[model samples]
Target: MANSLILSYLPRGSVVHKLTGTTKLIVFLLFSVATMVTYDTRVLVVFLVMSLAIFKISRVHYRDVKLILWMAFVFLLLNNLFVYLFKPEYGVEIYQSRTLLVQLIGPYTITAQQLFYHLNMTLKVVVVIPLALVFILCTDPSEFAASLASIGVSYRIGYAVALALRYIPDVQRDYHNINQAQQARGVDISGKDKLMDRLKGSANILLPLILGSLNRIEVISNAMELRGFGKNKRRTWYAKRPFATRDRVVLILGAVIAIGSLIFTFWDGSRYYNPFI
Candidate 1:
């Protein structure tokens, strides 16, 4: 359950957990937009600090989100590499200057401009990813569905989202159980095995897991049908929550940050702040 915290809620009593789910979702949306749309290093640095602070406030341990963050780090690294490979001169064009660092193959020379651009690009993800993980970790799926409904989204869609979030942990638990059962039966899926053999063994585990998931899905669908789900124009949420003062404050802060990002990024008629000049 702890290992599955990335996609499942922790049900903690942290300040982040107490806020309405809608508020967190809105803040995530606004925060993501604010960070992504601006390239001001000062702005991005501040956003990064704020995001880290929020993650700490959420009280989710580093271990709870380490896998997701590490995965993002790998992806971010690859993205930067691919960008440089495809467009080595993109930063030079954007910044309108080039301070050469190393001359590599033909057009693949490393430059100060490119590194600066990539640094800002990486910072955007560094800021947003943790905040997103915090939101998912702290908010209960049922309350999140209710929050979605409160925001004028369809209740059916909200319920579906909640079910998806709930199912991640269920699938994880199922996988662990099945793995243990198979391992006890002498099936070697351990890392000691050759990579190919381990993959082959995994297929055996995957087939049963998939079948179990299908069975669970069928059961859930039948239960929903029996309860006349989707028959009403609007359904009520079991964990419906209203926005309190704290939630309002969070919402307003996100809005202000988003608006401020727009102003800072576009005030000079460009999306970047070039301190290199």
Candidate 2:
């Protein structure tokens, strides 16, 4: 199960792959802030495009990105649904004009404003998702742990972060296998089954998955204890390497971008302040 999600972690030789995990993490947080500060569709679109360009340079495969794209699409669909339902007026107000796009059956009308709102939301995901994926996929887990320690996180905490990142793919694989096993047992999870029955079947799958995960966690904890995970006031890393000049440049660039974004937000008074009125 761990292997399945971890397989998506591409081993690459790009500059991004060589970057210290701590630096990458700081940059990722900054980019996330910049993304969240603006509601302007144009700004978000520009950032999203820039992010995609970085993804291309990082050399992560297209297939891996496809998963993120699918998730983003689902988010966009749900965002539009909610906006068009309860806050249709706010969506209509964003573009500062009422321009009808299409009218669906059952009294639902799509407007330009709603379209732009959904577009902006999608763009936000686009800008953040690639960087998030790149940081995880490119950095080795052990190296990341060491980098985290250098940044003042305890070694134990750093290890936990790596484990958590690895756990995501593990859980996804476990869920798939559990679903298949349930299906093999003549559990009807399809459209043919009643909605309540399907829900119950899914809940049943979760039981074993949760138990399995807890067991795995216990095993890891015991192994760490055996090795004196927290016994030493200092820990040594086999993969530890000093950050290079290039790394410093990257960190500086990230800081500049973050600071510049904040400055622009404050100066224009349009960062967190959405001037829809």
Candidate 3:
């Protein structure tokens, strides 16, 4: 049960884990926006390094998120491949320079500009993934909900987010149990089985999973309603905490990074850092 959970908070008592949820959420938003707003390789590399440092501080092991990281890599590779396939000259258009490295059939020529653009895009993904994983793995759902509420988000919405995060592990556990039970009953869901047979077995699992999820949702809604949840415009959060000095410092640093990134990226009237200049 402990090893199977993904995206649920782990209490490691690390500095990142000890920080108030509000600080983490706000800082994450700032860094994410800053990263997406800039195409400067310098800034992106700095952000990537900082993100990795923070991930290390959060005490999350690579082995814990190995599957997710691999999935992200695969998806990133496919996305770049498709982008190049559809618009092989997009980088040249953006950078206003073209240096052909290799000529390929059907207008699919490789160029330095294309490779550089792809490198920046890949860095964005790599930078953001570590920060996001740290946020998800270090934050408790209850505290995250309170953090959202502190930022003036609706309590109902905050609670919904909390529930979703809290339920991810439960859903995985349920699916595992159901898959095991079905296999015991002769449902061939193993990879050694034919693809069609596996699909059928998976379909059989989906029905029960959906029904079970709906039932759990209904029960939760009824419980909340009976307890007079959402009866007022505001509600007190059980996990709310006051911001400490560290929280304030982090938030200030986040603001500096965000504003500095904007200035660095656009002061020259363009987001791209043109080495061809």
Candidate 4:
């Protein structure tokens, strides 16, 4: 079940994994801002390369992220389809030019500008996904909570965030176990089953999963209350890590990149790079 989970921190000794959670969080934030601040294709390509480089440094296997990558592509495809369906001339409006490449129907013509705009949109997602994966895969949930607390976030809120992240794998494991149990009782959710049958069988597992999750939540709440978990305004984190030289360097670099993107993006007086000009 751990193998099937979307995002659980991997215990790797890579350079990205060695950074403190605070550093990773801050750098990720900066990278995200930089990515969103520009529609410049060249800047996005740089960010996309940087994201891949960071992902490689993290030593997370493709198998670990294959499912998520597929999901992301599927989502990107659907999003692009919907965007074109609803607003066919969106790119023409943005780039202020429409060099028609093909005419599918009345309002569904394809243009170079539209393809270019969508290319930028695709690059944005491609750039951000890897960085997000690196941050989530490399940082421990407890350390992430500590990072939030170190940045002046409430410990209770930080702990809640940690719990949610930790629960993702737990919930997946529960679903797997429940699915297996039901299969033992002659239910078929395997590929051998019809699509509708598999879906119904899966739905059946949700009730028990929800009940089990609620029971676990109650047990955890009781234990926390007994230990006076929120009695004080501050709490110590055993996983808290201090910033090191590498962390400082990464943060400085990230800040520069973020600010540079903003400046470069607005320098031409528009976020969109008008090569059509």
Cα error, residue 250 of model 4, in Å, equals: 0.8
Q: TM-scores of the models, in the given order?
A: 0.96, 0.75, 0.97, 0.96
- Taking every candidate in turn, the Cα RMSD to the unseen true structure, in Å, is 1.3, 4.3, 1.1, 1.3
lDDT of 1 by residue, 112-165 (tens): 999999998899889988888988889998988988888899999999999999
Please list all clashing residue pairs in model 1, or write none if there are none. none
After superposition, which runs of candidate 3 have C-alpha atoms over 4 Å from their true positions? none
Over 1-277, each residue of candidate 4 has an lDDT whose tens digit, in order, gives 5566889989889999899999999899888988987899989988898899999989998989899999999999999999999989899999988899899978899999999989999999999999999999899999999999988999999999999899989998999889899989999988998999999998899999999999999998999999999999999999998789999999899999889888988997988888998
Go through the candidates in order and give each one's C-alpha lDDT: 0.88, 0.77, 0.92, 0.92
Candidate 4 error regions (>4 Å): none
lDDT of 4 at 197: 96
Which candidate number maximizes TM-score? 3
The lDDT-based order of candidates, best leading, equals 3, 4, 1, 2
Model 1 segments more than 4 A misplaced? none
Question: On a 0 to 100 scale, what is the lDDT of residue 15 in model 3?
Answer: 98
| Local accuracy of candidate 3 as per-residue lDDT tens digits, 96-205 | 99999999998999999999999999998999999999998899999999999999999999999999999998899889989999989999888899999999999999
- TM-score of model 4 (CA atoms): 0.96
Clashes of 1: 0
